[model samples]
Target: MTSASELLALRSELTGSLVLPGDDAYEAARTPWNLSVDQRPAAIAEPADIADLQAILRTATAAGLGVTVQPNGHGANGDLSGVVLIRPKRFDLLAVDEQARVLRAGAGVNWGRALERLDGTGLVALAGSNPEVNVVALAIAGGQSMFSRRYGITARSIISVEFVDAAGTVHRVSDADDAELMWALRGGGGLFGIVTEIELALYPGDAIFGGGLMFPAEVAEAVVTAAFELARDEPELGLDVGMMHFPDAPQAPPHLRGRTVATVALVHVGDEATGRAFADRIVAVAEPISDTLTSFTIGSLAAVAAEPVEPMPSADFGVALDGLDDAFAREFVDAFTRGAARGLTRCGIRAMGGAIADELGAEFAAVGATQADALMSCSVLLFDPTIDVDAAFAPMRDLAARYPGGATLPTFLSSGATLADAYDRDVLDRLAAVKQRVDPGGVIRSNRPLG
Candidate 1:
């Protein structure tokens, strides 16, 4: 425990946003997206620079206090007791080198900043399902998206990184330097340290077409079949699709605003003419009540999906499957739709693997071939903050077991309190070894292991 006097002196030494127990913003500062997760840290430090982070690290260690560093509160898990919460919201910096086809963003930067920075460059970075999520945290957690079938998971797109370690030392990790740490940090979350900055491989694209298309629930089987057939051919054309069942919530779109339904969110990452033509092919199968399928630059793409930005309690868990065949699609949708009506779950199945399964043979690979190009990512989402998480996840787990694809991507994983159940043997072993080396004292333990 830090002494009151020590906390006071430490506050004076830091040059950044600092919130103590008595501060009005302290409670808000400790609140994460999961309303159930409440941290009562000795102090919440939003460091202005790397030096400020180093000082906080040394002080916290000396005081026998742990530190929980988060870019955005979306992915935070487990308790943060007797700790100093370090948030890097002040370190927002993004630089794009168009010629090099890479983007460098600071820890504080989010998708909003990345989109703004990538404008006019005719380049698009690997973005998550929702653009409101943090860029670095998502990248490290093995990011996946509807476009993943073409570009591959987000972690494979990283070229280099700058992170601060447990001892306050900052190191640049890349294939050319510190191979082991680079491999570990890629998909291991923030176990090694707080990533200060990252460079991601970008693709040239002034315009790409993609958006949500809602269909009547009755045609789900036909929709899944047509989509699979389209996936077989259109992958070379940068096509990706998702079929999701949303609850009859008020927040849903008017056409899909209520009643159980399967909405297909599709994307074509090519020229405008080709994208529109492909979209026409989709609309040919079944008329969509609401369609946002149109060509747009990366900067304006977020509007294509129109995701919410405010923080709320959420549970995200998924598994890959062989394929979305008619029989399987009908059964899967029926099970989930029935569950959703009872206020048990909201599920989505994202078609995976095309150009994404091409295998770059990069240092950090996400979901090996044995795992990729299977079918779709089957996941459940729930909003009840007090929902019984373990019980809620059980049905999904059983459903995943019925499918053949093994190993769930780490980024889509939530509440993985158990190591063995959370990861397969290979990943579990590698992650455990990396944790041992980087955080030897086990000082960094969150939902995922630090050591």
Candidate 2:
């Protein structure tokens, strides 16, 4: 173990600071963005620069420890007993090369910042719903975007990665520079090294006609029908349908308060008429109480889902399906109906066809969702930490068992999930081979590792 004296002395070498076991801030420092996660790293280090990062690696080597990075900790694992957590707070760098049509952001930059920066630039990158998630993290973990139908997944958009290997050596890795490492960096879940920054290819953007419509829970099947119909016929639209049970709390949106509603959120990268006609299919199913579907610039893409930006205790259960059968729609709706009064807050099914279903390059990262046709998930969000997990989500687990299928995206993997849940056996073996070659001693770690 790293002695207390050595750990204390190591702090003096950093421009930032460190919080060890006994420090008052240690408890808060180790907690992840998802308050439900409880990880106890031996120490938490805030590396101001590359030198500070190396210093932590040196100390970990001396202490016989593994190093892991969790800048925002959206995907924090259950246990981190022997690892040192490195929070790259100062790695916040966001730059856009308009002429080249590229985006270079450090690990600290979140989707919210990137979207705000590219607001009216007539350029759009593959970004997710939750704005607070780091852009680098999302892309590296094989992000699913509102534009996936046209642009593909976020990982495939990565042009280059600035990484620090297990030896604490900084290297700029690209497809040409290091094909093997670049392949792993794209979607291998940060197991190979610690990335400082990444360059992403940006796509052209115009005003988008997108938003959401909330229908009564009784019409959920029709809304689901509309979702799959669009996924099959309209390959250009981006939308997701979910059954949500909003709590009757002061913090809850007044419109969604104390109701179990079926909501369809979407974005069509085209004119208003085209988007409205697509939405009308859902409207034709039943009269919606709430409709916010409108035309806006791609800059406002993050606002479509209206996902909460705050942190709370939440449990997510997800799975991938090869293809949905005729029975799935009823199975999904009926399962959640029995679950809502119990604790299942929201269950959603988003079609993942088109470019998203297209395979990554043979040499690129192994993102399993690209092979699957759709992604489904159920989540339970509680206010306090004392929530009974098994009691709250047992029905979800039972429901998940009913759908025997393929793999989920790494980002959608349930808590305590291993890489095996997101990749096939062959892919797992390939990732393990890469891990052995790049991190022989297992010096670097991430939320999801090959182990």
Query: Evaluated with lDDT, which candidate comes out highest?
Result: 2
Candidate 2, residues 245-352, lDDT tens digits: the string is 887788678987878888888878778998899988878878988888888876576786678787788888888764455466666677777777777788777767
What would the per-residue lDDT of candidate 1 be over residues 206-290, giving only the tens digit for each residue? 7678787777777766665666666666764444444455546665665554555556666677777877776676677887767
Worst 10 residues of 1 by lDDT: 366-375
Instruction: Find the candidate with the highest TM-score and give its number.
Output: 2
TM-scores, all candidates, are 0.89, 0.95
Which pairs of residues collide in candidate 1? 253-257
- Model 2: lowest-lDDT 10 consecutive positions: 360-369
TM-score of 2: 0.95
How does residue 155 of candidate 1 score in lDDT? 79
